[model samples]
Target chain A: MKILGAIIIIAASTWAGFEWAKKLSERPKQLRQLKVALQSLEAEIVYGLTPLGQACIHLAEQLPKPLAWFFETVNKKLEEGSSSAQEAWDSSLNEIWKFTAFRQGEMEVMRQLGATIGKHDRDHQQKQLRLALIHLEREEGEAKEEQVKYEKMIKSLGFLAGILLVILLI
Target chain B: MKEILDVLPDTIRRVIEQMDTDIKKGIEEIRIRILRPLEIIVDGKSIIPDSDGGKHVITPQESGQLLNKLSQYSLYALEEELKRGYITIQGGHRVGLAGKVITEKGQVKAIKHIASFNIRVAKQKVGIADRFVPYLYDGKWLNTILIGPPQTGKTTLLRDLARIISTGDIARKLPSFKVGIVDERSEIAGCVNGVPQHHLGDRIDVLDACPKAEGMMMMIRSMSPDVLVVDEIGRKEDSEAILEAVNAGIQIIMTMHGNTMEDLFRRPSIRPLLDMGVFDRMIELTRANGPGTINRIRNQHGKEVYCKKVI
Candidate 1:
C-alpha cells in the first residue's frame, strides 16, 4: 500500500508537470491561431465591410475554443444593445484573459485594439488592425522563445522534485 | 418606422413609443440635434413631442449612440454614407447626418463629429400612382419626368410608379414590364445592400447608390430594361444619359427638383433635354393639397393634360 501511494504521488506530479508543459507549448500555438483569427477579422472589416458584431460572430464560428468563446461573448454583449463596441470588446477580453496563455503585453495589445475596432473609418480601422497584428506577432515570438527554453526543463523538474520527495520519505 | 426607432437612443425612443398612435402614424421626419428639443415633422410642420414634464433636449451622447446604432456599431462600413452625409437604413428610412465636414484636396471626404440627424420616414404609398397610370401609359409607358421641390413626394410617387410598371395593373390591363431603377441616393428603391427594402415587384432590378448618369447607361446596356426609373436628375451627364436611354428604345421615368416648366428651362444642364423633347410627359408636384398632390401634367408639346381644380 505504501509503494502504491509513492507511485501515485509520482504519477500525480508528473501529470501536473505535463499539463504545465502543454500550456507552455499551447501559448505560441494559440498566439499563432490568434494571429490567423485577427487576419480573418481584418478581411471581414476591410473587404467584407461587415459590422463589428457580425465580424465577431463570424470569428466565433470559424475559430477554435477559448478564442471562439471570447468572440461569442463579445457578440452576445453587442446583441444586447446596451454596451458599446469598445465596452463589449474590453469585457470579453477580461473574461477570456484568464483562460488564455497570453501575457500582459498581449492583453494590452488587445485592449488597445478594442478602443478603435468599430469607431474609425475603413482605412483607420485597417491601420489599427495591422498595428494589433504587429504587436501580437511580437508577443507570439516571445511566447515561442519562452516555450522552447523552459518547456522540457519544467516537465523534468516536476518528476525530479517528486522523486526527491519519495527519497526523503523513504 | 420600427427600424428608425431602433437607431434612436433609449430616452427618445421611449418618448416616441409613448406617443399616440395617430401622431405616430403621421410622423414624417424625426429631427434630433444636440442641445435642442427633439422635434418631429407631421404634414410638413415640426412639433416637439411633449415629454412627461420637461422638453426632451438631445444630448451629445444620445446623438453618438444614434449614429452608432445606425451604423450597426461599425463606422468603418459607412465611409461612403458619411461622405454622402446620409445613411439609408433598413425599411428604406433615410437618416441625414450633419456634422463637421472633412475635406481632402478641396473635396468633401466625410462628415465627422455628427451633431444632427434627420430621420426621414419612407412610407410606401402603394398604388398612389393608380390615377396617373392612364396618363403615363399610352399603349406604351411614356418617357416621363416628375418635377417637384424637396418634401413634395416626387420620390414617393416615382417609387409607386415603378411598382405599378413592374407589377402590371391587372384591372388596368397593363402588362408587366422589365423595370430597372438607378437609385442614386438609394431613395427611390430604398435598397439595403443592393436588395430593395420596398415591395417593388419580382421583375424589378435596382442599382443602389450608383450615380444617376452612369447607372442609367449601365442599366440600359446590361439589364435592357423596358422601363428605366431614375431619381433627382439635374446634371448635364444625366440629360445625356437620358437621351442615350431614349435612343436605345427604353422607357425612362425620372424625377427632377423643380416647381414649374420654367424651372426646367432656367437650368442650363436640363435645357438640352427639353430642346430635344426627350421627356414625353412632365408631371408637377406641389404641397398645395398636401404632398403627392398632382399640380399639373403637361404633354410633350407643353399642353396641360390635367390640372388640379382650385377648390
Candidate 2:
C-alpha cells in the first residue's frame, strides 16, 4: 500500500511538471502565431486597403483560437462604431490576457501598433506594423531560448523533489 | 433629411430635432464647425440653434465624436474620399469637409483636423425634366448641354432627364432609351452598395464614383448606351471623351457650370466643343423661381427658342 501511495505521488508530481513545461514552451508558439497574424495584417492593409473591421474579421478566420478571438472582439467593437480602433484593441488585449500569455512589453508593442493601424496612409501603416513585428520577433527569440533551456529542468526537478520527500518520510 | 440627422452626434442631433416643424422640413444644409454654433440653412436663411436667440456652440470633443461616427472609426478606409474633400453617406447626402491640407509635391495627400462639415441634402424631383425632353429631341436624340450656376438644380434636372430617357415618359409618349451615366461624384444616382437608391429607370446603368473621362469611354465600350449622360464636365480630358463618345454615334446629354452662352465661349475647355457644334440644343437654368427655372433655350446657332418662364 505504501508503494502504491509513492507511485501515485510520483506520477502526480511528474504529470504536474510536464504540464508546467508545456506552459513554459507555449509562449514562444503563441508569439510565433502572432507574428504570422501581423504579417497577414500588413498585407491586408497594404494590398487590399480593406476597412479595419473587415480586415480584422478576415485575419481572425485565418489565425488560431484564442488569438483569433482577440481580433474578432476588436472587429465586433469596430462594427458597432462606438469605439475607435485603438480603444477596441486595448480592450480586446485585456480580455485575452487570461487566455494567452503575452508579456507586459509585448502587450505594450501591440498597443502601440493599435494607435496607427486605422489612422494613417498605406505606407505609414505598413511601417507601423513592421515595427510591431520586429518587437514581437525579438521577444519570440528570447522566449524560445527560455523554453528550450528550462523546460527539461522543471520536469526533472519535480520528480526528483518528490522522490527526496518520499525517502525522508520513509 | 432625417437620415442625415441620424449620423450626427447626439448633441447636435438634439438641437436639430428641437427645431420648428416648418423650418425642419425646409432645412437645406447643416453646417458644423468645432467650437462654433451649429447652423442650419432653411430656404437660403441660416438658423442657429438657440432657445432665446443665443447660439448653442459645439465643443471640439463633440466634433471629434461626429468625425469618428462619419468615418465609422476607420479614417484610413476613407482616405480617398477625404482627399476629395467630401464623404457621401447613406441616403445620398454629401458631407463637405474642410480642414488643414496635407499636400505631397503640390498634390493634396490628405485632410487633417477636419474642422467644418457642410451636409447637403439630396432632393429628388421626379418629372421635372418632362418639359425639357420634347425640346431635347425631334426625331432622334439631340446632343444637348445644360448651363446653370451652382444651387440652380441642374443636377436634379439632369437626374430626372436620365430617368425619363431610360424609363420613357408615358405622358409625353417617349420610349425608353438605354442611358449610361458616369456618376463621378455619386450625386446623380446616389448608389449605395453598387445599387442606385433613386429611381433612374429600367435601361440605365451607372458607373458610381468613376472619373468622368475614363468612365465615359468605359460606358461607351462596355454598356453601349443609346444616350450617355455626365454631370459637370469642365476638364479638358472630359471634353475629349465627350467628343469621342459623340463620334461613336452616342447622343450626349451633359451639364456644365455656366449661366449663359458667353460663359461657354469664355471657358477654353468647352470653346472647342461649341465650335464643333457638338451640342444641338443648349438649355440655361436659373434660381429666379426657386430653382429648376428655365431661363432660356437656344439652338446650335445661338437663336433663342423658348420665351415664356417655365419652372
Candidate 3:
C-alpha cells in the first residue's frame, strides 16, 4: 500500500507540472493568433464597412475557441440593445480572459482599444486597430520570452514542491 | 409599430407602447426631443404622453442613448445615412434626425449632437395602387407623374404600383413587367443589406440609396428595365436623365412634391419637362379624403381627363 501511494502521488504531480508548463508555453502562440484575428477584423471594418456587431459575429466564426466566445458574447450583448459597444466589449473581454492565458497588461490594451472602436470613421477605427496590433505584437514577444524562460522552471518547481511535500509527509 | 418601439430607448418606448390600440395601429410618427415630452402623431393629430397630469419628458441622456440605439452603437458605419439626415431601420421605418450641422468650405461636413428625432412608421398597403393603375395603363405604359405635397402618400402609392407592375396581379390578369426602382433615399424598397423588406415582386430590381439621375442611367444600361421608376425628381440632372430614359424607349413612372399641376408648372426643375410634354399623364393627389386621394388626372394638353367626381 505504501509503494502504491508513492507511485500515485508522483504521477499526479508530474501530470500537473506538465499541464502548467504546456499552458504557459501556449500563451505566446495564442496571443499571436489573436493578433491575426484582429487584423482580419480590421479588414472587415475598413473594407467591408460591416457593422460592429456583425463584424464581431463574423470574426467569431473564424477564430479559435476562447476568442470566438469573446466575440460571440460581445455580439450577443450588442444585439440585445442593453449595453453600448465599449461596455459589451469590456465585459466580454473580462469574462473571456479566464479561459485564455492573456495577462493583465495585455488586457489593458484591449480595454483601451475598445474605447475608440466603432466610435469614429474608418480611418480612426483603422488607426485604433493598428495601435492595438502594435501593442499585442509587443506583448506576444514578451510572452514568448517569458514562456521560454519560466515554463520549464514552473514544471520543475511543481515536481520539486510535490516531492518535498511527500518527503515531509513521510 | 413594434419594430419602431423596439429600436427606441427604453424611456420613450415605454410611453409610446402604452398608447391606445387604435392610436398605435394608426400611428404615423413618434417624435422625440431632449427635455421635451414624447409625442406621437396618429393620422395627422399629435398626441403627447402625459401621466398624472405631467408630461413624460425625454432627458438629454435618453436622447443620446436613443441615437446610439438607432445607429446600432456604430455611428461610423452609418456615416452616409447620417449625411442624408435620416437612417432607415428594420421594418422599413425611417428615423429622421435634426441637430447642429457642421460645414466645411460651404458644404455639410456632418451633423453633431443630434437633439431631435422623428421616427416615421412604415406601413405597406399592398394593392393600394389597384384603383389607379388602370388609369395610368392605356395599352402601353404611360409616362406618369404623381404630384403630392409633403406627408401625402406619394411614396406609398409608388411602392405599390411598382409591386403590381412587377408581380402582375393574376386576378386582374395584368402582365408583369421588368421594373427598376432608383430608390435614392432607400425609402421605396427599405432595403436591409440590399435586400428589400417590402415585396417588390420577383421581376423588380432596386438600386437602393443611389442618386436618382445616376441610378436611372445605370438601371437603363445594366438592368434594361421595361419600366423605370424614381421618387422625388427635382434636380436639373434628374431631368437630363429622364429625357435620356424617355429617348431610350423606357416608360417612366415618378413622383414629385407638388399640390397641383400649378405646383409642377412653377417648379423650375420640372417645369421645362412639363412644357416639353415628357409626362403623358399627370396624377394629382390631395388630403381631401386622406392620402393617396387622386384629385384629378390630366393629359398632355393640360385638360382634366379624370376628376374626383368621376371616381
Show where candidate 2 strays beyond 4 Å: B51-54, B138-140, B170-173, B192-197, B303-305
Q: Which prediction has more favorable DockQ, 1 or 3?
A: 1
Per-residue lDDT tens digits for candidate 2, residues B149-221, read 9989889999998998898867666778999999999899988656887888889899999999999999999
lDDT by residue for model 3 over A25-96, one digit each (tens)? 888988988898889889988888888889888999999898899999999989887547888989899889
Models sorted by TM-score, best on top: 1, 2, 3
Selected candidate, larger DockQ, 1 vs 2: 1
TM-score of chain B of 2: 0.94
lDDT of all predictions: 0.91, 0.87, 0.86
Point out where model 1 deviates above 4 Å: A1-3
Q: Residue B128, candidate 3: how far off, in angstroms?
A: 3.4
Evaluate model 2: give its lDDT: 0.87
Clashing pairs in 1: none
The DockQ of predicted model 3 stands at 0.58
Question: Each candidate's fnat, in order?
Answer: 0.84, 0.45, 0.55
Candidate with best lDDT = 1
DockQ of each: 0.83, 0.46, 0.58
